[model samples]
Each structure stands twice: as structure tokens, then as C-alpha cells.
Target: MSDNKKLSYCFDVDGANFTSAGEASVKVKKRLREAGFDPETIRRVSIAMYEGEINMVIHAGGGKAEVVIEEDRIVIILTDEGPGIADIDQAMQEGFSTAPDNIRSLGFGAGMGLPNMKRYTDEMVIDSRLGKGTKITMTVYV
Candidate 1:
């Protein structure tokens, strides 16, 4: 392949299935490895992406994710058209989750997703509007 330092991948998040929630992140991990990222960097990127992916599937019904690999960092952008987060601060808390009971029953919605995402990424930004949607951008240095 061409030696461009920039690479991108897009994925359509599916809400119909929880088992496949992390598919996009998994693919990203592999791609990052093929692109010669170190194991720690790959792990950090994958963890952040996977958490964002799971959140989208759980709360947004569905969404879209884009992963961009640049010379200095990996950027993950996740957007959804579902109900937006009401309180970003609360959502960012480690023990606060608004997921439905059904979702909680699945052993997820532990309220750690957002916090973990932020912890694993070098930078994270969330733009959301009540009743509109949410767009999360996260970056991890390589």
C-alpha cells in the first residue's frame, strides 16, 4: 500500500445486536497493528474506541464511527442520532449511567464506558444536544 501516514476507516454502528458492538474497534486494532503502532498504543486506542462504540449502540440506537490514523495520533469520531446526553458531567462520572434496565441486564451499562474512554484517550471531546444527538471525538497519541 501507499506509504501515506494518514489512514481512515468508517463503520456503521448497529443497534440490533450487542454482541457485535465492538466490531469496529476490533478492526481498528488490527489496522493499527498493521500500521506498526506499539502494543500500548493499540490497546489504548482500541479501549477508547470500543467504549465509545458500546455507548453508541446502547444509547443511540445506532451511529457512525470514523477512525483516522495520522503520523502523530489516532483519532476516533463517533456520532449518533439518538437522544442526546442530558448531563455531560454526570455521564462522565464513573458510576452514573442512564441505560435502560434491559441493557443493564446484559451486564453492561455499568456507567464506566465514558469514563474509561476519557481515561484511555489523550484527548476527548463530546458535543451533544438534548433530544438531538451526540458526537464524540477522541484522540490517542501513537
Candidate 2:
């Protein structure tokens, strides 16, 4: 807390490895807990980050995440170079998912990733291009 300097963390989401999809979120939860964030705040941040990580794995093939802890908020940014989201509004719907049948069979791709991420975070913004990539930024107030 000295100097009002923010704490920041970065993680690489490896889409090719489903076994480690949520590792970054888990590490973040540990760090937040050690930093003395309240239980509820920790829960929200972890859930939102986990959801975003999953989306990056299943949809984008892989991505990067950055989490920054400031005096008033926890910010999570996810970036991926996969096939970009074609319709953000449609993707935001509770049950609208473009995940293939194979992914769904693994008990994922429930169409809840974006919705859950938005649900637990105080603010969320999505930047996407159909032929390029996607970037999602989420914030949870402290």
C-alpha cells in the first residue's frame, strides 16, 4: 500500500491446454486473499476472471490477461487473437454461445461466460472484430 502504487499481474491463457484453463484465476484468487481483499470481492473477481479465461480457451485458442489492483477497484483485461465475436449483443445473452458441440460435451461452453463475467464485475467492456480478435475489460469495485 506504500506510495499508492498499484499491484499488477499478468497471465498467459493457453487455449491449447484445457487442463490449465483456470490456473490464472486461481493464482489471482490466492493473491487477492493474501492482499486482504474481502471474501465477497475475492469471489467476484475470481469468478469473472475464470469465465473470461474459459472464453479465451474455448473460443479464441489462447489469450493474455492482466489484473491490476488499485485503491478502489480490481481491473481485469483479457485479449485474444481468435476469430472475433460477430455479435456482442447476441453473445451477451444468457444462452447464446458459439462454442462447438465438442466443447459443450466437456461440460463447458454453456453460453454463460460473458454473462457471468459481466454479472460479477461492476463494469465490463468488450472490443471485438469479426476477422481479428477480442479484448474484454472488466472492473470490480473494492
Query: What C-alpha lDDT, on a 0 to 100 scale, does residue 110 get in candidate 2?
Result: 87
Tens-place lDDT per residue, model 1, 93-137, is 988999889989988889999999999999999999989999999
Top-TM-score structure, candidate number = 2
Q: How do the residues 1-142 of candidate 2 rate in per-residue lDDT, one tens digit apiece?
A: 6588699999999999988999999999999999999999999999999999999999889999999999899999999999999889999999998899999998989899899999999999999998799999999999
Which residue pairs of candidate 2 clash? none
Q: What C-alpha lDDT do the candidate models reach, one value each?
A: 0.92, 0.94
Model 1 misplaced regions, further than 4 Å = 1-4
Poorest lDDT segment (10 consecutive residues) of candidate 1: 1-10
Candidate 2 error regions (>4 Å): none
What local lDDT score does residue 23 receive in model 1, on the 0 to 100 scale? Answer: 95
Candidate 1 local Cα displacement, residue 78, angstroms? 0.3
